[model samples]
Target: MDAPLPPPLFPALAAPTDRPALRCGPDVLSYAELARAAGALAAGIAGSGRVAVWAAPTARTAVAVVAALLAGVPAVPLNPRSGERELAHILGDSAPELVLAGPADELPAALAALPRVDVELDGEGSGAVPPPAEADPESTALIVYTSGTTGPPKGVLLSRRAVAASLDALAEAWAWTADDVLVHGLPLFHVHGLVLGVLGPLRRGGEVRHLGGFSAEGVARELASGGTMLFGVPTMYHRLADALPGDPALVKALSGARLLVSGSAALPVRDHERIAAATGRTVVERYGMSETLMNTSVRPGGPPRPGTVGTPLPGVEVRLVEEDGSVLDGSDGETVGEVQVRGPNLFSGYLNRPDATEAAFDGGAAGGWFRTGDMAVREADGTIRLVGRKATDLIKSGGYKIGAGEIENALLDHPGVREAAVTGEPDPDLGERIVAWVVPSDPADPPADAALADHVARLLAPHKRPRVVRLLPSLPRNDLGKVLKKRLPRG
Candidate 1:
């Protein structure tokens, strides 16, 4: 009696095809095969409201998420590296009816109490009975947990409409189509690898080849073998830049890519230049956060410059507001202000935390604008150049507000410096003192504090120069390659 339901999130899956849809390491699946597999799995979990997926960096993880979406069930992806306390919190908060994982995956003690379903990739369902594709678009599709740096990780509820909008907008921005083959080894839990990397391609009828783990060799092999696009964070690009000189295979692979994107954190201008110099391609940087799926990205056509995240995506409105709550009118590329955005790509709210949900929407230019907490300067051409996080990256010293990112970029420009993180410490005279954490190219002979201080003073204002320089073997980073500034030693 009812009309056949429409596939909103993934219309590509409905079409008949034997083309390879997803590949993780040695495991690969065709579109038809994946549809059948997910359909079968979906039937088993149809009535289950919310499902917990152990997001292992494997093909089975992708299958679990797809099955959840097919059944119209909200799926919560648990980080594999989450500790007991964090795991317990997520499990208790979400309270999934069943946990889905690969057969070989060992369940942690926190998840051992829940009923488990092993996602079987080979399972077959009658191709005639596909999961109901039509559903309320506002229904929660995913419950992604935040990093919880301030406190316990809050769950972000992303709806089907939001997911669809984000993917379609990105497709338009990057010129992403079914013909494009995306390659990445990013973890399956995060939005970059899961939503954008896997789901983005699936929505467009494109193919994806996940390397399981990132390496220059793996990247080269995939790109050489039909991979057209690459997605990575700053750390990955840095490694690629480091390898380009010695590894001709890596150089050739990157040169062949149609598009290369960097996100999660700002890719240093030096690394961007290095990669471009080695390969005739420039790595385009995009700005996004967990709350907002994607806000801005460099245009796909050509002439993507370094250090700017380009203009806002279609259907997304971005504005800058000063600390006094005045909307920035002109794009002068100098005045720094907090970034605010409003678009369909935004999440519904923080699951079970109405207080946080309200706070996230407290201040904005136009009503309903989600405060991004990220600070940036808008260029005359409407491009966004990020300064840093408002909480940590914006440093007020000697009656002037300085962004740590600019100083960090200056430090990275030095040939002797391999990596750098700049932070502000309490100073009685200047309000806050600039501190530089340096990872030297040759740790045995680290650059002197005075030389590095002078380097910053010459490049930027004398007040922006580091008051103290501490040499380290490596900077503290998360799985996404974002610098964990809070984890840095205070002394």
Candidate 2:
């Protein structure tokens, strides 16, 4: 029609310009309109700019994100209601040349000087025009920042090639079809929401239902609202299960789902079974991180194993390697050493942090290999079982190793505990023992420490059972919804 622009610069996504692209509230924008809105916004901003969209999960924010991608600018999504300190820090880090906000909300005085773009195409002032560059596989496409171990936030750079390859692998491996309708209710900032939930579906012209804020009730309602798939974190699944009556509807929708997926954090094997019991479907727990969108997933249509994050997807090349970069000989399961993966889906580098990049590549080179900090033992059946995270999440007691996740999973299966996070605290003899912080689903019936200890005693060996268990309001979780064990209060 009008010069046929580069097929919208992505293959997995079909520019469904004729079909309704974003269905939000009472408004629906056709794919053509959505593209135009994004293209206009893209054209309005300078290349080396930052665009902070509404932090809340929404179809509108989804549009802004895609438009930013096509326009060749980086969009830093932030919570619209972020605290002053958080907003301040992110603004400083991203250093956007402009800001994007909807009508009616006044621009923050801090960003008053920055040109504001109205989603309705009101701000027409041209800053520097962004040069047209083909979406390079290795070039940085997005910079997602996380509160670093200790310093300013660190941004994980994902290039177009990386995301594209990820989509191809997921679509093929999970057998996602363009016709699938996924009800995704996770926060969009993390890799799971962005890579798997949003981009994965959109790239293939699948339908997505968005919740501005996640509510288990809202998610369940939406799932009943013509959804064919459910993709969310284990926490989300838990909330959904709790909100529902008996997990029947949860299971019904989940069982009826073309696929039910969980990632970003471990899906406790027990929760997987609990969700399946309630919903009548297996919640396929997958594995990946910010560095790699999705390398392995528990089978969707097949077994949906309780503890294993299934084999590597078709395009992904996985190997077990020693710390010194030597490949291991352990495919008895599927070669479980430190998981070193090379594929188009893996990220190029961490943004502007050469030292971090160098350290990341210590186990391998820079093609597509990511030395995942996860210590997993691949089984002979091609399934991988995660032992724990190297950076954190592993607890040592009495010279043996126990994954905090394993202990937490056992606690959650007790039916009394709602949430659990295990960490290593000082112990005289065992060096370090497992300390679990638990949140009770039923406050009145919260199990006592002795009761929980006994329950865990049945599930784990005497040594692996939690040495100490404490009830809490919630576990410390980071922005990405990962438990911050270091932040857990010492008992």
Candidate 3:
């Protein structure tokens, strides 16, 4: 028989004192305190099947998740901002035994029907409970829901082995250590802020400070005061770029940081250059999704290119395949193909939806490759540059397969343009006509559609220019700052 695996995801729990394990706003807990608190919560819910977490962006949410993991129960992180219908669907689909939340957090109408457990920082514990009984590596750990662009949101099953493998791989790739103090204000529902932001620090036995909310002043203060790393999406970085010229404190904070990373969506090259110019620090970008925790990242010691997502992490095999399913022989850095990945980091399958699960894997479970549905160009050096989603971002027009991302980037380069989103609408002659939705840098001096279209043609191929351009006050965006292209008005 195989030896039992240790229950705690964090191995260094036994040897810690005085160092903050997690700090959100003013709530702080040391490693010893965390162990005590989590142990108590774990003991209380040791035998629950699957659990739902009211994932508020707070230390309490972190504690509840850790406690669930310690008890070896799969956790479902519920997004706080979800609409009533979306919330109802997720709760019904996952069918968790109970929901966990902080003592003071108010439950939404969607979660009120379920049994509730409140977590307390100063909760009593009999002391550290015995390690949970050894479970199979394939046991489900988290059931994260997708954005449901195609259909209803489906829960992606993530296993213990997958989480451990991904976090460890990222630790090695990022040179993450206990000495590093991570800081971010991302919401707790997504993988970026939850798994990478919260769990990443816990695994390394380091500290994490969540701002409770994001602001340039808040981030600057945290980074200026012992925070070594900052994680954010492009929107947050754009705010940083906008604030750099006036805020000397912000400039000093960014310049002194050990690492700056952008994810959840691609960071525009213009914002990258702006931040770099102000602070002389290159912000690294990584590629990941809820289905796959993290596939690639710019290694800590590697060069931080403006737009590339570096190479695959340790144990992850990433490759590009043509539409016909044949793998590219060698990347020319121009051939666009679908991104396929196979690694321990991959999710088990979608929860209870065997048909959908079966369709995600290429050959079978034995084949081990999962089609990501994202299209990208792979450089010869293995760096992956995402073009966009296969369903929406790839525009087939005039016998040319152009990625909307490139044209969007070109449009953003215009001095008068502040934000840009590109989409393809049906056209009889071109198959799909490129449409650009833009926000002007200055509303009074907005660039004409012809001028902006000409700008893109000059920067890239003429065919890539927008056939129609519409000016909006702002692009529709999600909590993670991803541009919601589907929500754009089709006129």
Candidate 4:
């Protein structure tokens, strides 16, 4: 009998008869019910390695994913609402022969149009127990794709060991209970939502209330119903803050959460302060990338320093190095270098493209360290504040290199600016110059170019400043809150 090592992800689901695992609107699935559904789907999938899941948000997608895992097939859950071209690309890239998908009442036709393999599992099954043959810890468990700023996209391959280790590490460090209800809606494509949103909560036996669409009203309703935790991006937080700025009832509903987490991209220090005051629940700012899962996080009620990603996580080792891949001098707190990490959770490699994979390890020679392209400067207290990505997000102006992220942080601090993107524009004098496309909080009251320039001068070094400022109602972005600065036309 082949025995799969007990998956670290299903301590809660391990005993399906013990509790209710998922609640999607009026539908509530117990551990037992979900286990049964997953088993049927798993049996149907058998072993195709990867299966495309085009289902809308339901107990169904969750069921299919778990089932696929049980049957030794890796589940590739695509965003069902994408265009035909996008879906076709996914199908072509993944090369999945099977797809289990359906559109429920809450899910519309748009979500159902993506390629899905239909399977008939009437929800009458119960191989909830992991396969007797434990899955290989080193086997490819997940393949998450990130839309590259410069190119099409790259598939980040994560192994089962990495996924299991990451989840186990999180559960051991963060205290959670079966009775806690976590409100989550971030898409399943990205690791932030998939690993943390689904894998982490389920690992701890916590009840998850996964929503398809996010709105203050909808979130408030769920929180009011006793959701103990909420995870969202900075944009989502801003919208929630806007919808109910300083309402006590709204705050209470938000505060009812045991934890409020903000991640995916850098959270503006200004927005963090405002939302913290409004809700009275300190938001735990976390740092993560598609390549490496979460690396650092700011604890609630700590000093809550501005612009710093505080401390390395458990079982995680971090080091700072120069552009030439040399370690930074400990004496210089201002020494900015690339962030490097070696951990159990580090990615194996890009799905294909050996050259790119080799290039990713530029800084990691000694240990199994994965080179994170983002540049960072270390503080005396050991918090690593990210400057920007050296790969595509850096801007050069007047013979000096500038991190667009640094300028964007300064722009978000302004009362009138809601969002901003900084990019390089062709300049004959300097190699390239800084240009910022800004989204004003109030479109009717746009800031003048001079006023914006003055604002930039206050925080950034002269060379780091954006010489060209354009006023726009909103900056273009991807499915995630990442600013698509490259897409904004330069004047």
- Whole-model Cα lDDT of every candidate shown, in order: 0.89, 0.69, 0.88, 0.72
Tell me the spans in candidate 3 whose CA falls farther than 4 Å from its real position: 1-7, 14-16, 129-134
Q: Ten consecutive residues with minimal summed lDDT in candidate 2?
A: 121-130
Clashes of 1: 0
192-228 in candidate 1: lDDT tens per residue?
9899999999989989999999999999999999999
Best by lDDT: 1
Error of 4 at 314 (Å): 1.0
Tell me each candidate's TM-score. 0.97, 0.87, 0.97, 0.90
Q: Cα lDDT of model 1 overall?
A: 0.89
Which parts of model 1 have CA positions greater than 4 angstroms off? Answer: 1-7, 363-367
Error of 3 at 15 (Å): 4.2
**Count of clashing residue pairs in every prediction:** 0, 14, 0, 12
Off by over 4 Å in 4: 1-8, 103-122, 125-128, 177-179, 331-333, 363-367
Summarize candidate 3's per-residue lDDT along 169-287 as a digit string, tens digits.
98888888999999999999888999999999998989999999999998999999999999999999999999999999999999999999999888888999999899989999999
lDDT of 2 at 193: 76
